[model samples]
Target: MLRTTIMGLCLAAALASPAAAHFQELLPSADVLPEGGTVDLDLVFTHPMDRGPHMQMEKPLRFGMLREGQTTDLLPKLVETVNGGKTAWRTSIDLKEPGTAIFFVEPKPYWEPAEGKYIIHYTKVVVDSFSTGEGWDEMVGLPVEIRPLTRPSGLWTGNLFTGVVTKGGQPVPYAEVEIEFVNDGSVTAPNDAFITQVLKADANGTFSYAMPRAGWWGFAALTEAETTMKSPEGKDVPVEAGALIWVKATDMGKAP
Candidate 1:
């Protein structure tokens, strides 16, 4: 008899427990990816402070935007963190043009001269919101993503290497993999064009980087390369290509 009562109480307690909740995160979007490669995006979302995600909490979250690359060397150029959700931490960018995007989309418009991806890292929360039993749902969100559909900068039949150095077929662990935009037929090579930071490979032997502009660029296992240089005595001397290597650039594009 005691066991039966105890079991009934346990069942009631289990039924009384609050259900697990889920919060829908909001993403900002770009209105346009300028043809000349300059565009501004709007960060808009409805945030109900007294709800599931915000939780009446003032603890700041981080928000920032980096870059994403497309297929073509010069594919059309286009446009991170958790909370403060603050402005001093954010800024805009100017891409050269021919950016591409590869967000999750149909036919996977990959390498097709056009593609799609959502603009990331903009920090703007809409003021008004309507509530429900669980929490308030956002009505409007900045929805933007694009695609240039260009070939991946670094293509391989298998995986690529990154971070450390390898020679004579030595398996260099921790080598970094990276891509650099170069003057191909895509863009005229803007004066502002510079090398992005080195991207390291993961344990899966994968290294990837995002591009912010559209143009012909190259991908290479970053390493010290020997180049022929003219010596002061007019003799050939070996020079290093720094910590860079490259692949061919292709036509890239970003969606509006």
Candidate 2:
């Protein structure tokens, strides 16, 4: 019983907190078009502020992108209300002209976390930008083959999910693989209702799963060392199953 309780706490701790910023910055979808010029937006983060003898950290303020997503960090724009008074911090951009406009915005710290080194809620945006990712195949120095495998027979909830985890052109053995849902943070601890499934790589950096559920999914993972760094501290750390690689499984014949 003691062991089970400890394990349960560990699992809860891991999922209880979020690690680093989801994506370093508000990544832009693609290279800025010639027509795209310097863009500017707002930045805001929420926190538990005490107003009366009784305090509540419930409401969330609408936010806008304040800077571009880049390796460099920038100043943040924080709007605060104290004693029924409102205060704000705003910043601007000068993509100046078009042509080769590489807009890089730094993420500013809006608010400090009440307990941890970071704000309980870490949020940011890029004015009019969106971003996605494509990893490098370092092994042989090429892009790897990342194909969704054919569905396994006699299964409905999940299909055969096979993908290559390569680096510098070769398979990354022992690399962890995972699938998770894209969280639309409407409320805190939103995924608490759903059970997330996980998988690991083999000596060949291959992974398989019986599918955590019959629904949309995203795939993500990192090298063992990298994964360790991202794991949160205090209580049991939560495992980070990366972005879901959306998949659909129409049936589950009889998951054996």
Candidate 3:
């Protein structure tokens, strides 16, 4: 009887533990469009480090692009798609001029039963068209955002990406930031702890991480919202607001 009781306690403990981190991915087909053309983007919410167990993302609250100080609504162009057997979104935009295009999405609040909270991630990605090299650091004016200090596009492997965490245009001191790489089944983690890399921003709300691999990396600055949301059970739960940015790193190699 004692052994069975102990087994029950262990199972409860495991269920109570925190689940893997969920990252909202806004991945573009190419970070740099040498010649102006249409670039496709994939919007998926999942544990990018594990590359599975995707969460269904409802239609976003807002989706748009910023180019040359003008914001264009792209929500009408979003097409429903499936990823990892879950609902996702996809859209494409044509760059007609040489400049930087910042695509951003504000997803609907997702209710997590385990955590007992609603999650809303404001995610964005930068695509440089014709290498304009300007407007890479522009802000999308999200409630919580990461203003990139380093150029967001055309990065080489091992480049240190830096950004400042902000809420309502003001810096968030010592914010918690989570980093994860988009796994393509080429690398494996030794343990669960190695799956998600975490760090804290300094007093100025600035943090940096060097990309170790040549692939897409996502940085999420997580914080609580000022208000709560009603969960499906009709209970008011806290809101977890995440400001995420995706960047691509390329390895130095000769072109074929």
Candidate 4:
């Protein structure tokens, strides 16, 4: 009887604790940059839907934009910023061309004690300048990446977003993807499960999810890294390599 009661209590305690989903956010001031204008970006490692317990981020290993089959280094523009007492990064870039610019960041491996592993989310976001909208489908060739089957820009609510998960330029069969919205603090989840929706890729490594409402939705595909890293406690731990992409959806119309 005592053992049964103890087990029940433990289960209840675990359920009572909120599960925070980690997301690497690369948010631009606007998804479509106007000609002769600058687009600002905020790079943070946090639980977007939960509004944080923002994690401290070290300097990114790589930060740049890929356009027209060329990559431009943007690391020189990053400036350290603080939010909720945690370190983050901010940068602004001038958009002069009429083509699509895909900005990406390879952050330093973050040690997550709660998960017992290090996490490195290779995050990317697309910005269309001057309405050219070209080159949105090009892959930046990260270790793990999501190649969007959809255009990834100017999406409407209820539109199905599809993408293929890839590692080392090869498709990953039945890859697991986690989807979450950048909650504006107005949206609340009824339970923890609703915070992050899970989906699996098809045999071709393609997964699809429709944005239920208009907002920024993030899709993260996690895979085991080929290498391990030393933890803060001097122990070697497995690495969680994540390929993350973000897109914005707009409402079709208002109610009558």
Which digits, one per residue and each the tens of the lDDT, describe model 3 over residues 1-256? Answer: 9999999999899897768999999999999998879999999999998998999999999999998889999999999999999999998899979999999999999999988999999999999999889999999999999999999898999999999999999999999999999999998999888899999999999999999999999999999999998888899999999999999999989220
lDDT of 2: 0.35
**Winner of 1 and 3 under TM-score:** 3
Against the true structure, what is every candidate's RMSD? Answer: 23.2, 13.2, 2.0, 3.5
lDDT of 2 at 27: 24
With candidate 2 superimposed using the best TM-score fit, by how many Å does residue 21's alpha carbon deviate from the native? 9.8
Q: For candidate 1, give the lDDT of residue 137.
A: 18
Instruction: Please give each candidate's TM-score.
Output: 0.23, 0.33, 0.95, 0.92
Query: Candidate 3 — which pairs collide?
Result: none
Residue 76, model 3, lDDT: 95
Candidate 1 ranges beyond 4 A from true positions: 1-166, 176-178, 183-195, 202-205, 225-256
Worst 10 residues of 4 by lDDT: 247-256
- Kindly indicate the candidate among 1 and 3 with the higher lDDT: 3
Better of 2 and 4 by TM-score: 4
List candidate 3 segments past 4 Å from native.
Answer: 1-10, 16-18, 254-256
Candidate No. with top lDDT: 3
Question: In candidate 1, what are the lDDT values of residues 103-138, reduced to their tens digit?
Answer: 110110011111111111212211111111111111
lDDT values, one for every candidate: 0.28, 0.35, 0.94, 0.91
lDDT, candidate 4, at 105: 98
Candidate with maximal TM-score:
3
Q: What order do candidates take by lDDT, descending?
A: 3, 4, 2, 1
Model 1 has an lDDT value of 0.28
